[model samples]
Target: MKMQKTNKWILIYGVIAALLIALHYVLQLSVFEVWNEYVPFLEKLSMSLFLIALIFMVSKIIRKLINTRAHLEGDRYNLLRITRLLAIVSSLIVATSFLFQNLYAAVVSFGLISLIIGFALQAPITSFIAWIYLIFRRPYLVGDRIQINGLRGDVVEINYLDTTMLECSGDYLVNDRRSGRIIRFPNSLILKEEVINYSGPDFPFIWNETPIQVAYTSDLEFVEECLLAATNRDFREHYRHFAAHEWEEWEPAVYFRINTYAWMEAVISYPVEPRDTTGRRNRILRYALALLNEAPDKVQFPEGTLR
Candidate 1:
């Protein structure tokens, strides 16, 4: 549908250009006639339209190429952005060059104009610069879950001045589920605020802990064993091969802690994929609870009241 629209406009421009050329010959309109200065203006206008149509056609082709060749979403998006930027810049340069007969004068004038615009649009310029920094620094890329300042979400788009995120945890929700709200913040904020990225080379797994409270009289060994059993059942297959090669020394472990209410706290520490944190924790807790129920005499959970 979009391609059809583009082709339609291109055809219109081609027809107009052909008509303009035919007009010059058919009407015998001289470029320097007494009252026919409109002749040259019409020619220039026609040429501009033709150039714009050509640019759009080229841009569309390049976009298709990028979409086909660039495997990663982020890479495809960035490449398309660059392509559009180049098209706009090139069109501006061509139009300006046509407008000004003297090339050097045009260059000098553009430089001064850009300097003035730079100072006038300080905030926007800063954001654009920050965008460049983001491209190189890669604090967070598209699809990466991140928390900047207090906002937490997956980056959906990174525009020239604004970064759009699909928010995860909003006011009502505490878990890491999507809130269906979107947030757009200035790119310049990256320079001012700390960015916490939950995705990286140690991807598909992040350190997570689940604390299980048991009565002080419970067998500590039994509690530890139950915690380990639940965790191993859920995560061992996922992490076993990668864990040994990527992180040679790290393994799932259970640590014991003393609670203020005299209850024994069993902290099950393990690695979990960011998206699976809540679900995995829920499963582990259910498994632990079911197993503890089987041996109630050995492992008892803390009651609501301290004593």
Candidate 2:
């Protein structure tokens, strides 16, 4: 398999080299003829050699740019920076080529050829442009948990064609939340889909819930107080900043209700860092249980309840 792959690559490279050589010779025969009268063969050769050298140099720079872009995985900022740099370099080259009228005319005449090439790569170019917008606007960032067009994941990379992710939720495996599978999402989706950023600048914390049940016979007010106290103790420091921020707009509160089914419902509502939600919920549950254990008889479940 490895040998076959190596041979295939060699064949492709050979074909490309042959094409480039053919193009160089064809251009030399056709274009250099006009200039041969004004410039000696040696000088023309030197100029031809320089143009060839420039093309190779540009090719090398393009390869490096592509490789550098590959490293910008999940980082929108770096991706945009690399893209802008490439655009600038490409523009400069095109502009410089225009300085030579004959060459410029020749290049312009080849616009149909360029158009054909552009048409062939329309999808990738469109995706790249969307990527540029994503980078500048920063709808999401690396490590941000987001749901876009029904796909949920932690973004792992942002590339030319697609953004890669470590899947978090959706139709995929449940409880295998830490599954190492990587997903590549096309950049074009940014234009077509609604992207929900779970960890955007404004809302870094997710609203978490910890539900507790107690007997209807328990002192309702007292259970509420105990539950609130437990929640405040376990998550106060963690949620304090967001709470304070929320307070500016609306008061933060933990809601409790006695369901019609004769169960005291203590729903501890709080904001938690999206990534730490699972662990934070566990801690809050443990604290709440400890608080309940202190008042065992008082906190007993309704008699005959299987739960």
Candidate 3:
């Protein structure tokens, strides 16, 4: 429905542009001498409007075609931004041409103006260049969770000069949950700092571990079995895609480590999506504890001060 409405508006703009161009020729019979001065304005207006509408129509068609392929969804956002920038540039060109009688003179004047503005807005110009870099290099996409500088968030918008993110695990939260805070940083920051994209490269899931403490008297074999069982069950129930232990080193592992206290730590490590880390840890801990508690004599846990 939104696409249809946008197409309708584009059609209206095209029709009005055509009528305006036709009216320029019809104005020769307006009989009013004052109307002669408005002919040039109408001509430029019609041309600019027609060009903008045409660009939008082509972009819309391209996006509609892209919508058929699920993999190209990320590219659609980049294309939309480029189309908007193109429209703004085309309108400026038309407006400037109408302002000067000689096209060369207009070009020279705009060049000088741009040079001055470039000097005045060095940071913003660098950010715009970085935006172009982002379109091609794609260190992170719109929906990818990334960490750059000191900010960690999910990319929501990448504008010409700045990128906006929905912050996660901010000052208010200890877990890997969204903090409902908006973070905006200059696009140029990517050039100066490293960007860590959770969704990119080869591995789709990050390695996370949850550790449980057990007394020295606990049955080490039983504890390992219980942890592995809990991990396998969680994988089968929640992440069936990883049920097979054939995907490189993504399979779950149970390892023992001596803690600073008298109790030993049995840690279960598994691969999980970045967004599901907290929940996955919780589920694995709950399941592992349940299985261990069923046989308290076999798997002893620390009590009192040692716990």
Candidate 4:
């Protein structure tokens, strides 16, 4: 239904455009003979408007097609940005040609004006260039959680000169929870700083580890089993269905090593979604502690520093 409406509007635009062109030529040859100087300018302006309308209409259709298909969200967004840039460039070219009668004069005038503006807006121009790089390279996209130069957040918007992020782990919080703060940073920073994108090709999960310090006298096998049980209990569903694949076999792995405090450090490494890391770790610890307490002889937690 929406596509039909779009097609109808496109047809209407085509008819009106054809009529406008026909009327423009008719007026130039007959009705506007006395105003010859202004007639050509008027005709060119009308043609330029029609061309811009066509460009935008075609761009809209292409954007619609991309959005409806199975393309990735990042690809769709980058394509939209590229389409908009192309439309703006095309419109400017058409308008410049229509407004300037001499091609040489237009080039000279544009060069001089651009030189002046470029010098004046150097920083902003660099940021805009960075924005273009972002559109093409896709270091990150909206909804992706990222950390750059100590600011960690979910990207909310990417403007022409700046990117806005909804800050996470700010001020009072240590977890990956949003802090109700918005961070607006210049896009040019992408050129200078390393951007860590938490959600990417290995998206929906990242490796996280929980370290448990236990007495050396405890049964190492029983401690490792308890840790494994805790993680499996928390993330069994994720491991069984969404995470496991032929290319990547996702599951919890346990390792043990001796520590300086005369305690055995048992680490349970597993895959966890970025947002759920802190919560998942907390739950695993709670369950593991309960299980360890039930079997005091088998698993004993470290009490103090090394003597």
Please report the candidate that would top TM-score against the real structure: 3
lDDT of 4 by residue, 1-307 (tens): 8667767766776776777677667767776789888887778777777777777777767766766883676676777777778888777776676677655677777788889999999999999999989987889988789999999999888878999999999998978889999999999999999999998855667889989888888998888888889988877654566635552455788898888777878899988887778888998999888888899978877785563
Model 1 misplaced stretches (Cα beyond 4 Å): 1-44, 236-250
129-164 in candidate 3: lDDT tens per residue? 999999999898888889999899888999999999
For model 2 the local lDDT of residue 29 reads 66
In model 1, which range of ten residues has the least summed lDDT? Answer: 23-32
Q: lDDT rank, highest first?
A: 3, 4, 1, 2
List where candidate 2 sits over 4 angstroms from the true fold: 1-76, 79-114, 171-177, 236-252, 258-262, 303-306
Worst 10 residues of 2 by lDDT: 244-253
Highest lDDT model number: 3
- TM-score of candidate 4 relative to the true fold: 0.82
Per-model TM-score on C-alpha atoms: 0.80, 0.64, 0.88, 0.82
Point out the higher-scoring one by TM-score: 3 or 4: 3
| Residue 265's lDDT in candidate 1 | 83
**Local distance difference test scores for all models:** 0.78, 0.65, 0.82, 0.81
The TM-score of predicted model 1 comes to: 0.80
In the order shown, the candidates' Cα RMSDs to the true structure are 4.3, 9.0, 2.7, 3.6
Cα deviation at 222, candidate 1, in Å, is 3.3
Q: How many backbone clashes does candidate 3 have?
A: 0
